[model samples]
Target: MGALDFISDYFSISTRRKKRKAMQTVDIKVKMDCDGCERRVKNAVSNLKGVKSVNVNRKQSRVTVSGYVDPNRVLNKVKSTGKRAEFWPYVPYNLVAYPYVAQAYDKRAPPGFVKNVVQALPSPNAPDEKLTTLFSDENPNACSIM
Candidate 1:
């Protein structure tokens, strides 16, 4: 009986260590319109146990929370503040061009999606070299008054 008790105690300690999960970071997309919305989300997430920090980006509508916490728990806490929340989904624009990559080009992409490439356009300040109109300055009928 004494030998059995010693073995059980050793197993219990190992089990406890295994159950402890490492700290993780979670990013969630939450649409915040004003300062008040940002405050509400920050306050709600900070209250959760094991939360070390909460960062909110109003421009990007993103909230990042870090600590030894379960992602689902943090998400639920933010949702409780009367705001819609979902895990942040990010995909690079370059990857979108290659449909062969299974992960990059998903049919479930967010709405109003556009590539991140820069578009080149003719400068409005540049002067036109030639005019194709019949009313050009050099044309004889340019001025009917003449």
Candidate 2:
């Protein structure tokens, strides 16, 4: 009986399953006024397939969902609960001197913060500032690794 079953299984065609996209964390800003709102938000996201966990912070009005689920789908699920939801915009910690401040929550980099300003843009009529510097190439070690 075992020999016949083994032979049949071995001859069966193997089908390749579709590869899934990389897993990502979906952070949504949903305002939950009370316990009921928090419960509803949590339940909606938890019921979604492939959602590993749902964390709702009522004080901060933030709902963080981690799993292989799509971010848009997670946002939609939260929105289905009748609460306004938007993708959480993240600001890099190091860029801002005071990240916790309310003004530092801008979608783009904060004021007076310069990032990746390696090269100055070329202007047709402008004077060459490169020629004005006195010790331009005096030190070979002045080159930045970045």
Candidate 3:
């Protein structure tokens, strides 16, 4: 039985199976206007140490990065390009959805030194008192109610 089995058997060197590392995709909101700005933003993030790929859509003004890096670290990289960055809710951590919508954040800053001028902007919750800077204990980064 052993001799017959040995005579019928053939030997060949080959890999049994390959293990692949899973990658995660994180979406970010950007305020990209032109093609140049989009490219610049994409390049900045794609060049990161852990970033695997970058896809920027100008119409939606969003940047999606694929990798296994930390989300906070990726967000910081996006902000370095002079664009506001936040977590995108549409895209999942797994690779399934091909295209996802990214929300863009654009803010306007007060112009000139007249900045020292006083204003009578009322508080959102207070509704009667004025506020220099609105502070919310719950969500500090949220927009103030108008």
> TM-scores of the models, in the given order?
0.56, 0.57, 0.45
Please give the TM-score that candidate 2 achieves against the real structure.
0.57
Instruction: Please tell me which predicted candidate would have the highest TM-score against the true structure.
Output: 2
Question: Considering lDDT, which of the candidate structures 2 and 3 is the better prediction for this target?
Answer: 2
* Model 3 regions lying over 4 Å from their true place: 1-22, 89-146
Candidate 1: tens digits of C-alpha lDDT, residues 1-146:
99999999989977775455678999898999999999999999999988999999888788999999999999999999999999887545544553334444445444433233333443445565234344577778768834
Better of 1 and 2 by lDDT: 1
Candidate 3 per-residue lDDT over residues 1-146, each given as its tens digit: 99766655533224345555457888776777888888878888878877788888766556778886667888898888888767653323233221221221112311110111222433456743224334454556546554
Tens-place lDDT per residue, model 2, 1-146, is: 89998877777634445678678888787888999999999999999988888888886678999988988999999999999988865444665454545544444433443233223334535566443332356645445521
Better of 1 and 3 by lDDT: 1
| Ten-residue stretch with the least lDDT total in model 2 | 110-119
Q: After superposition, how far is residue 84 of candidate 3 from its true place, in Å?
A: 1.5
